[model samples]
Target: MKSWSSYLKQFAIAIGVVLLIILVMDYNIRLDELNRLNEKATIVRAQATQAIQTQVALQTQIAEATSDRVTEDNARNNGEIQEGDQRVVPIPATGVPPLEISVPTPVPTRVKKWQVWMELFFGE
Candidate 1:
């Protein structure tokens, strides 16, 4: 009877340890799932920002293009001008091409990913 009771106690302890391990494993799995969800959310937000920027860029380009078209149309439609209208001058093309503007292109500054992360976390 004593030996049976000892074995039962050992079985109970073994079951308890298994349950504890299972609980710990379940907690870690939930944590991992939560971490994955957070990462996905971050990626989704970045993509949304990028899409918004792209849409804004496209809208700006369309507006500029439309303005250029309107200007060109106005210039073409002005057939008979009364007074104070600027005369359109047609310059004869010479053998040599006109000199191009020599404005220097702006150079992009180098940025590190960690710097961006730090700026995001630390407010600049």
Candidate 2:
């Protein structure tokens, strides 16, 4: 009877040891999964932030496109003029265009270092 009880106790200890090992392996796997999920969440947040910024930029562009100034500029680009604005017709002059007078830049002559030293000593 003592031998039977001893065998049962040894069996229970063996089962406990195996269960402990399985639990430790499961905990490690769960920890690794949690880390992977956190990394993915970080990436998703960055993408969401970029998407929001793009949305804001698009909204700004939409607002600017609908403004009165932009509309007027577009109309002018399409050659539409407002009422009471006179269109001027320019005639090309047969005479020559006026000449621009520019002062000539003096050319600097480079001298040798020894010539410079000779000038410094004897150019008095």
Best model number under TM-score: 2
Stretches of candidate 2 above 4 Å error?
77-79, 94-124
- Write model 1 residue lDDT over 1-124, tens digit each, in one string: 5698899999999999999999999999999999999999999999999999999999998888689676677766876443676767798798988888999999999999999999999974
Query: Candidate 2, residue 79: CA error in Å?
Result: 4.6
Clashes of each: 0, 0
Q: Which ranges in model 1 have alpha carbons more than 4 Å from their true place? A: 1-6, 68-70, 73-124
Per-prediction TM-score: 0.50, 0.71
Per-model lDDT: 0.89, 0.96
lDDT of 2: 0.96
Clashing pairs in 1: none
Candidate 2 local lDDT, 1-124, one digit each (tens):
4698899999999999999999999999999999999999999999999999999999999999999999999999888899999977788677989688999999999989999999999998
